[model samples]
Target: MAVSDECKIKFRELKAKRSYRFIVFKIDQQQIVVETLGGPNQSYDDFTSSLPSNECRYAVYDFEFITAENCQKSKIFFIAWSPEISKVRMKMVYASSKDSFKRELDGIQFELQATDPSEMSLDIVKGRAI
Candidate 1:
């Protein structure tokens, strides 16, 4: 699907913030699905493995994350399951110094509460709560 203009704007704003990492999502039918990509280190293996058989219909890995600087990003990963979304969409928001990345990730848990996947578009942008 084509990305909305609002989502483009929000993405630009997010990039400007230069945060370490963030997850973007959208509500699909009655379930929320990750709108971003995942990789070996960032995969939602644990979460997906724990789901009931009927709930495990989607692919575990839907996106690929690529970065030029590996040393500067955070290796820390977090997992959370909300009835809000049925999948994970964790990703690095920017590439910068290690210290800056760490600082940005420190407060992300709190910020995540404000994210409403229902408001987000399919492209993971143009969300009202973004």
Candidate 2:
């Protein structure tokens, strides 16, 4: 699917203004890492521990993460968008697998960020910022 112009613009703006951080964890006895960018500062500050091992398929080495008290209350997912195929693929899983947490990853999303500003484009952008 083609990203909206507004989304593209917002994505660009985020690319220019946001700072990204990564977190490694495991679920179901599986190891996965999440790399998140933007959102509130607390998103990175409120994490208690790493996620458990689960099925993750986003990046090869690193993922995305944010530290927020509110976000901690749910199972977060890392999905990648493929402009060539017009679809979003779930690559990494970030969820609070603890029964006490009882939080479902709602509204959790991602976009690919380009290291080079010139490479930022729908055709080039893969996943949300991370």
lDDT of 1 by residue, 1-130 (tens): 2223433343333344432133343334543344543333543343244333222121111222333553333222222223333333321111112223224323232111112333222233212112
True-vs-predicted CA distance for residue 84, candidate 2, Å: 22
**Candidate 1, 74: how far from true, in Å?**
7.6
In model 1, residue pairs whose N, Cα or C atoms come closer than 3 Å (at least 3 residues apart or on different chains), thus clashing, are 7-126, 32-85, 32-86, 37-63
lDDT of 2: 0.28
Report how far off residue 6 is in candidate 2 (Å): 1.7
Give me candidate 1's TM-score against the actual structure. Answer: 0.22
| lDDT, residue 69, model 2 | 44
lDDT to native, each model: 0.30, 0.28
Worst 10 residues of 1 by lDDT: 90-99
Which stretches of candidate 2 lie above 4 Å from their native place?
19-38, 42-78, 81-130
